[model samples]
Target: MDDGRAVISVLLADDENLIRAALRTMLDLEPDIDVVAEASTGDEALSKARAFTPDIAVLDLQMPVLDGVEVAERLREHLPNCGVVIVTSHGRPGYLKRALSVGARGFLPKTTSASTLADVIRKVAAGGRFVDPEIAAEAISAGDSPLTPREADVLEHAAEGASVEEIARRVSLTPGTTRNYLSSAVSKLGAANRYEACVIARRFGWI
Candidate 1:
């Protein structure tokens, strides 16, 4: 970093090897950027971060062992100086909100252009933040996730076509309690039934 120029050290973590290679290639083209490490899973990413102490970490939202939000939280605790950028195929408003809430410096979709990705890396490395404009707009219109933690768990099980009894067993709650949670979720989503509630919640990326 002290090599006579402002060099941004970066760590790239994605489940896909091709994506990591492409990103590294793109970042290598930037004069002030240096990809310090690469990982294919959240655990590997954390290990690499601990070893390399990169200035910025570009993470894919879906990864083995831990997801991007969890990794970001861990990094916030252990590597506070490393900026986080979450990139995902699902550009859901709720996901974006969660990323920002966990102190991620940037939230971008996988469809982002190479130039934009580099720009965001530089900005975050410099202590600034960025959010995908479309994601932000959707978050503004979608309001907040309506379902509580229990309601969301119930609805997610329902979405997978689980029966009320099965949901109760999985969540360690009685059938009556599970039904109540489902009913609450249905009312909050303004849906006619549990199935409809599941659809609505999934559409909003709440579960």
Candidate 2:
């Protein structure tokens, strides 16, 4: 936890250079916060976090190499003391749940105001958690995902309009088993077909 007198160090990880620059500019203006490192990919973020050991990591939910939730999980395992904050344009219920499950201290949409973001950083640094109220409401109403982990993985592979053979190869399953999984996912999602299932799963961030 931050002691109020000490400046909280922060690491910013976003693929977009302009967004990162804007965040750095805004955060550096605060007296108690310092933007100590910047990374453009999840791999880079993890490397930089290890090198700098920043007090907080502000990560874009979607990034190259790995996503924010994956990075957060890794950080929780390796750098347990560093708090994670995930900011995304896609604030779907499942994404929020995954972020929280991975021990993210803060979750907010990219549209959050600079002042609000700064305050969230301070709060997280003080060993507190923050989730945008609107996002939290949606998460509560949307409820949990019905698909199991393997089903979700199959659906994600199916999302790109891949053939069952291709998806099976990618996921290392037999074409028959892959078909069964897809069928189960489609049935559970109540979709007419795999394509429809993909749409439903994506809307709920299940895949």
Candidate 3:
């Protein structure tokens, strides 16, 4: 399939059609890279990844059904050989932290040029890591999150004005436990209430 050159296969997962098209076009022009599959949601991305088994996956950080960080974690568990790169418009410090923790090899903003993305893909495929310098600096300044994972989960569920019972149902926790987590999160952030906690967590990209 290649003139004695090893081509890096890539799976692109972004909900935006235009972005996908542009990326595919850009990557297709590279001699050493091939766009093997594309998906519009996180679930679809996972399914296609399983089917295609691409060498690398370039994922949008905020896909539907499951976020890119969640997808990256699943891929790490199910397809350890496939490297992951997360690109996002958000570029929040907490989001960057979560992506890296999930074993993503590359993290960059959507504003990155196509040539830069190609270089990142090449680097990640070669068992290297890359993170945008500005994002890295912001993450270092943001420090670590104070809330526990459970507490952060509850806060995220509460972000959309969900009641404690609904949050419990979504997270598979008891209503009382959900309330406790929410309270703990609020107290940790010095927020007056659950809503304020959500705002603070979101602003800091903790949720």
Per-prediction RMSD in angstroms? 5.6, 5.3, 4.7
Q: Cα lDDT of all candidates, in order?
A: 0.87, 0.89, 0.90
Candidate 1 vs candidate 2: the TM-score winner is 2
Q: Per TM-score, what order, best first?
A: 2, 3, 1
Task: For candidate 3, write residues 94-171 as lDDT tens digits.
Answer: 777788988999999999999999999999999999999998998887778887656877788899889899888776
lDDT (Cα, tens digit) per residue for candidate 1, span 1-207: 345768999999998899999999998988889999999988999999999999999999877667788799899999999999999886766667777888999998999999999999989988999999988898887779977655776788898999999988776679998899999999998999999998888777677
Candidate 3 backbone collisions, by pair? none
Q: lDDT of candidate 1?
A: 0.87
Q: Write the per-residue lDDT of candidate 2 for residues 1-207, one digit (tens) a residue.
A: 445678999999999999999999998888889899999999999999999999999999878667798899999999999999999987767778888998999999999999999999989999999999999998887789877545776788889888999987765578898899999999999999999999998887666
The parts of candidate 3 lying over 4 Å away from their true place are 1-4, 147-188, 198-207
Clashing pairs in model 2? none
Model 3 residue 92 CA deviation (Å) reads: 1.2
Report residue 88 deviation for candidate 3 (angstroms).
Answer: 0.5
- Give the range where candidate 1 is weakest over 10 consecutive residues by summed lDDT: 146-155
